[model samples]
Target: MASVSSSRSSPIGKLPVDVFDSILSILNEEDRDTLKNCSSVTKQWHDRCVRIIFSSLDINNKNTNAFPAFQTWLSINVDAAAVVKTLRIWKLPVEIDVDQLASVLAPLAGLQNLTLQFIREPQSQIKSSSPLSIQGPRSRSLNTLELLLPSEANRSMLAALTVICLFDTINTVGMQGFSSLKPDLRSTEGLTKVHQLRLQYLPQACASEEMNMFSGIMTSAHLRSLYLECHSPSSWDGLRILSQTFVNLKFVDLDLVQLKNCVKDVDWTTLWKALSSCAQLQRLRINPPSLVDALVTAPSKLFQTSLTSGGCWEVLRELVIGPGYSPRAESLPNRIQRMLWDLPGIVRHDLRGPFPNLDTVTVEVPLSAPMQKRDENGRSNGLAAPTVVSSEQVKSAIVRALPSLQEEGLLRITVIGRT
Candidate 1:
């Protein structure tokens, strides 16, 4: 028994510090909790494991009072706070006293990532002040900043941080109350370094003013990706601003359900005129289904003519068009097929089913046609009417369309049918 016990403990004790660190890195919160409870087994393990496990701190209103206590603890154990890499504070309903927040933020100057999701009421009006007044210690090591302000007005704290150049990469900056922000994002210095921007629930009250400010940021040429989610119809102005200003955009994800309103006012000629300038665009996704519905509902002749007159679908490599709530009359698959047929550069077509690339054709055939599947002598079963296209006809169409596809060295074909 003594010999077996000695062998069991030897391997764990012999593990290198780097191997232990790697194992600890992959642990989730529960696993880390277990490790922390067991840290007293050895002095070397206790020192290294405790530091790695407690290197991230999350604070919110529920434990707001604890922050001061944490500061007191950190004063005695400065190395503990200095090692923290990620700091997240969110949804503090009450206005945080700036002095209190500054004290907590001061010790977190070594943080590599910081996220703040602050809630402020829309009706509440606060006097404007220069963000410079709230500047804290600069974090030269910080690289990512995520701000989620639910109120329309800017958070003076975040604006101040941006002006002070606290972050280097500025990975994601999301604004929830965009309509409420004063249209002077330029006031926050170093915004041009932000690579990803997301605007959620645009304020309906002040559309144009907010959009103009948004346009100024996108025109900076350094922005690489944008995500816009409009909750109200009036927020469509931001889409118009993007369509007009962000000509050099390479990737865009637009969730503007209210885009139909913008489409109503859009001059196809002028809209495509601006879109054509996105010469390097590689990926584009439009959501909420309304945009496609609007396109299909437009008089067919007008839609076709607009496509022929230089639309923006010429260079797309990947396109996703559904999983949205739209009317059945807007046949997305048929519309996509038409668009691909019209665009000469679209060599690959991926749609609803087995049709992988347009080079090959795939078809699904039912074991029995609706008419043939009727209960006696092929008469109506008095149930919902079945589709008219037969499986054999669909297979025939594939054979028909194959010659043209094969001419491009695409003879591969797949067929699937349901009984």
Candidate 2:
């Protein structure tokens, strides 16, 4: 009994410190919970793992209290904020206290990315104070900022922009679900080092005021990549801002989902006409930049009329038709066929045909089209399940419609996200 007790109590051969260190170093954010549980294993391990685990702080409705707790803890332990490199807060309508926001962010000297998606409409009556700038060269490490669903660019948004000015490293700034009904434009003035901009989901009837706000704050010459997606046709008119403001633009992505009551509601030529006004573009003819990527949801007839006659798509080096970047946008079957055929004598015009650079038009056809199957009466769009159309039949249909691509051995079909 005495020998048995001694054997059980004695420590087994332990892993060497270097081997244990090697194993712990291999752990990443995916093993965050495991790290949290094992932090007490060693003092050195705790210090190293804590930084890795807390590098990204995501605060949403589920963990609303976590932000405040972190705020309180960071107030006492200033060094703790250094570990956090990214901060995200989503679906929370809490009033953004600008001064408090600055105070919280000031200590996070290494914070590189920040995303705020608040479910609130800015009220005109909400009083605001100038954002207390978090001054420090290290604070400039912030590189990406995504501001979504704020609806209006009020003082809160302005304060956020002010905070952004302290960080010149910020390369991308996204403003989504914003309308033209913003506060006075004079306040949003600042020169940002923004290289990429995303203006998505703007409301109908966008006008000069909303578009002017972006041109006022951002540097036109420095901007390179521009992405615009909205339901409003007038939003294209806003693209005029790029003509003078963003002169150095190299790439443009558009996901315009026009509101069509009937078949003829959308003017097929409107989008191409707007794009014709890009920086180097002339009045009638187009000498657009190298790339113009779009995920247009218009009908095949619209594409047939527009693409052939609209502008010189022959300049396209890369083009993706079906659901390239936007989920809300879709490509119909007939639209792909329209893209394939080059009807030279169909119209009196002889401008568009035989895309020289475009060898393959990569179209991503979602299996959800037939697999999930959309319903007529349901509010929910699609539920991924099974197909009414078989993969073999789909291939056969493609072969019949587009024989040239297959003959050249450039055609390939893939079915994804369905068992």
Among these predictions, the greatest lDDT belongs to 2
lDDT of 2 by residue, 1-419 (tens): 00000111111112124433444466665554455455346656655555654577665544445456556656654544677788886664424554455656777877778887765534423323332232434236457898765555434455455555656656888876654345454543334578878876656666677567666667666677777764655555677654457655656776544333322344546655555445332111111111112212332343345544445543444444332221222223432343322221222242224234445434344354433334664232455453355445545665666566657654555555532
| Candidate with best TM-score | 2
> Which pairs clash in model 1?
152-180, 364-416, 365-417
- What does candidate 1's lDDT look like per residue over 322-377, in tens digits? 22233323232343332232222232332212122222222223333333124544
Candidate 2 ranges with C-alpha deviation above 4 Å: 1-42, 58-72, 90-99, 119-139, 152-160, 182-190, 240-244, 256-263, 277-310, 313-315, 323-356, 371-387, 405-419
**Model 1 worst lDDT run, 10 consecutive residues:** 1-10
lDDT of 1: 0.48
TM-score of each candidate?
A: 0.59, 0.63
